[model samples]
Target: MIRTLAFLVLLAGPAMAQDPAEAAQTAAARLDSAATMLAEARSGEARVDALTETVRAYEDGLSALRQGLRQAAIRQRQIELDFDARSGEVSRLLGVLSTLSAAPTPLLMLHPSGATGTARSGMILSDVTPALQAEAEELRARLEELALLQSLQENAAETLEEGLAGAQEARAALSEAIGERTDLPRRFVEDRVSMAALVASSDTLQGFASGLAMTVAADGEAPPPDASAFRGELPLPVDGTILRRYGETDAAGIERPGWVLATRPRALVTAPAAATIRYTGPLLDYGNVVIVEPAPDTLFVFAGLSETYGRAGEVVPQGAPLGLMGGETGEVQAILSESAEGVDAPRSETLYVEVREGQDTADPASWFSAEMRSTQ
Candidate 1:
């Protein structure tokens, strides 16, 4: 019995220090917060902003759920491996305990070495029984935890589905609100005919931008607020990874004076600082584009959006929604399965950012804060 228990203890290995339950609780809290935000978005006065926030909350919640599920899967696998390795030993230990329990008391008391041997055996059994009990309790706890983690993953599927739906709904509402919105202060009205002519005449983005800079407001609207103070302190317009730096050559051997960011499908793009919309429409080879001027002779150009928001010459506040990247959001099952298999959801859309000061194109990396870059 002593040998069997010792063997079992050796096979049990080290206890898992990290708690999956805590991770599950944290994920649950994030999901709850997302749900609350979704509810508020439905009735919020600033529907566009509220819905944008709601979509962000859902994205966060879904990310947390994926992480939590991954951790739980890892913990579950470890526990299962431990149990599989110790199964034979545990069964033998149980058999020995059962035999001892069923044996006659007189037979148990009797020993070849008489009372002294019996007393020693009793003392050893007393110690061994508690250790065995402790081992059993630990195994039971592990089994319980495994069941809980499994249940958590199972329930997470539904939660993930709900979160995906909520995010889609919010994004749709935000887009609709943007289309209907007309209250933004306009600095000037763009001349569509002149802009079209400029677009046709200009061969390079620089030429187009230079022509745009020369445009004057017929209504004499005040210039956009000075953004020089916020230089090197602005947040990124979108959450993404820097795919290519300014002037980086691509596979086609083409070098562009802009940063290309890899972002998830439908990721929100916002204004990095208070800026006037210089242009918002398709231009040249770039898809839908948004050009905003934050200060005199300074332009921030965002390209490759699936949709553009606001309008030309409108002053948008910092963090205002500018647009969304294109691509379909991943299905909940696909996301969960990928998470369980330790695969990260891919960033399927790209956004191009360019900072132009006067006629010179500056590196966007120098304009954004280090902390903001680090997160990307």
Candidate 2:
């Protein structure tokens, strides 16, 4: 904010612009307040919030300082903008202090809380310390190790007991790092962070490009589920034969509760249910797909498509000719988000059927009757 006016002064005439060293000194004072706020937090929530915001403030202040310094150097035709701490002023000019003014990139490095920030009760915020942070880093490293193990499944490995020992260690570290006193709640955090991290993994980056694709927007009152009047056994969105049954599978094989087709010709698909479209675009390799809210907590995803008929935050219904079914290469394969195994964070399409009353998952398969079977 201060930089705006200072730049204006520079435009007017020489000797008008504020000294860059003075600007840095002024910005540092504000950064000290942010740091103090972060350190003196009472609640874990306050601490985390303060810490996050402090990091941003430091970054923004640093950026403003660097810009000011660079401009001073340019105006004076000097190689470097030197600051004299003893004199408390800008003196010699040498070169840009780019590295000294660098700020760390903000990443969601901490585990996901799964608090949803919507839970009204039984929520525990994280109390982070240097020790806790080290543990968190260790746990994250172990998770990466676990992913590698999953990839190299067929090789000679330690016994299951050994694996359990490692897992327990990781769980303990994570719990301490996040201040999660309960196993169940901690597991939720672990799962969410792990999944998100997977989508962001370099080798797993394609997973984002694959699976049932959808873009999750900011929190809002999600539109009600659109009844999928067009849903049936017959596959139009996906064209192919049954390659794998829905059940347990061999090592490294994709085993989903829902059936998997061989492959289909990618084409324009439609919204299978009546509801607002959450996302309509190419996710991963699910090609282009559509995500619709069919009912409360029920998400219907149509993947391996060619084009989309709608966009994110739009309303659509079943049998709506979404778009052309065929894509650039014309290959189609859709996975139901009904099963967690089918969900790929970047491309994952697993459904979330919140336990409303007496049922869990609501058995989407049951929704498809014998007649529905005849169509796909």
Candidate 3:
């Protein structure tokens, strides 16, 4: 009876019998095996219900593991600081002994007599004749070292205390949070919980805010810049064949209005008319492109090129090579003109004149001079 009682006491444990992580892992594996016992059953109520509960339990266990891990880290840091404080004290005590021996000054020792004897008044002396002096020197050196060590210990103790307090505060907060989360739906478990999720939520909110800022907001239709003040008609930016006709059909076979296609294959693309470059870079879907401004309220687009020669607001002359044709997938797009207010109308680069329905996209066939179209 005594043996059984003792066995029960041992099993109950003063140490609380915490499972080694490995043992907990093994238990998890066992539960996983149980959960999969009837995975083949398509509509068994018992199997489906058991599997769902198992999944929820697994997720809960994962969240608990993460919390436990953070607590473990706090404990480890506390232990490390405690060990370092003890070791530092020991080192300082040892260093004090070394410092006292290095000097022969007797006045600094607590017992000057011991220090005096270690160093004889005689001009020449053997090492053993000055035992008192050595003792006093050793003691003083040890005390000095101890003093520094105490300073360090004092600072370290304060720092350690602060760290521990902060850690405890954080741990308490997490403990309260965990307790509160017990009522949280299973959706709160696993990757759905913790700092990473908070960070992700913050990032998502930031992006949403940015997108909201980008959305156009206004009271009415947009205003158009005055185009009638322009001095003369602008020349076409490129000298190339119209690989695809304007507004008739697109490369995707979709009928789009007010855009023209010209493919030079590998021909040089240049600025048309004397104009300031609006943008000298690739455009979405159009590949490498250049946008130039020849007059107030008018934009010239030269797209599908391998190179660009100017920057925004830099003046470009007509026939100046902006870049070589990119002509990727055998299609090149150029706009002789465009309006800042249009939905899809393009600025032209293929003709001197274009047909527009009071919009930027114009009929290239009407705008192209008969003489220019033959070669362009």
Candidate No. with top TM-score: 1
Model 1, residue 82: C-alpha shift (Å) = 3.2
- lDDT of all the models against the reference? 0.74, 0.36, 0.37
Question: Alpha carbon lDDT of residue 137, candidate 2?
Answer: 59
Off by over 4 Å in 3: 1-235, 327-359, 364-370, 373-376
Poorest stretch of ten by lDDT in candidate 2: 181-190
lDDT of 1 at 93: 70
TM-scores of the models, in the order given = 0.82, 0.29, 0.29
lDDT of 1 by residue, 1-376 (tens): 1122122222222322233333334434554554566566643325666566656655554554555566566677888888899999778777877888899989977879988999998898888889888877887788888777666667666666666777787788888888887667777887777788887898888999999854544543656667888888888898888889999999999899999999889888988888998888888999899999988889999999998888887888887889989999888788878867767778889999999998999998778863572212
**Model 2: per-residue Cα lDDT over 18-43, one tens digit each:** 56435434545554665687568665
Model 3 scores a TM of 0.29
lDDT of 3 at 70: 29
**What does each candidate score in C-alpha RMSD?**
7.9, 29.3, 29.8
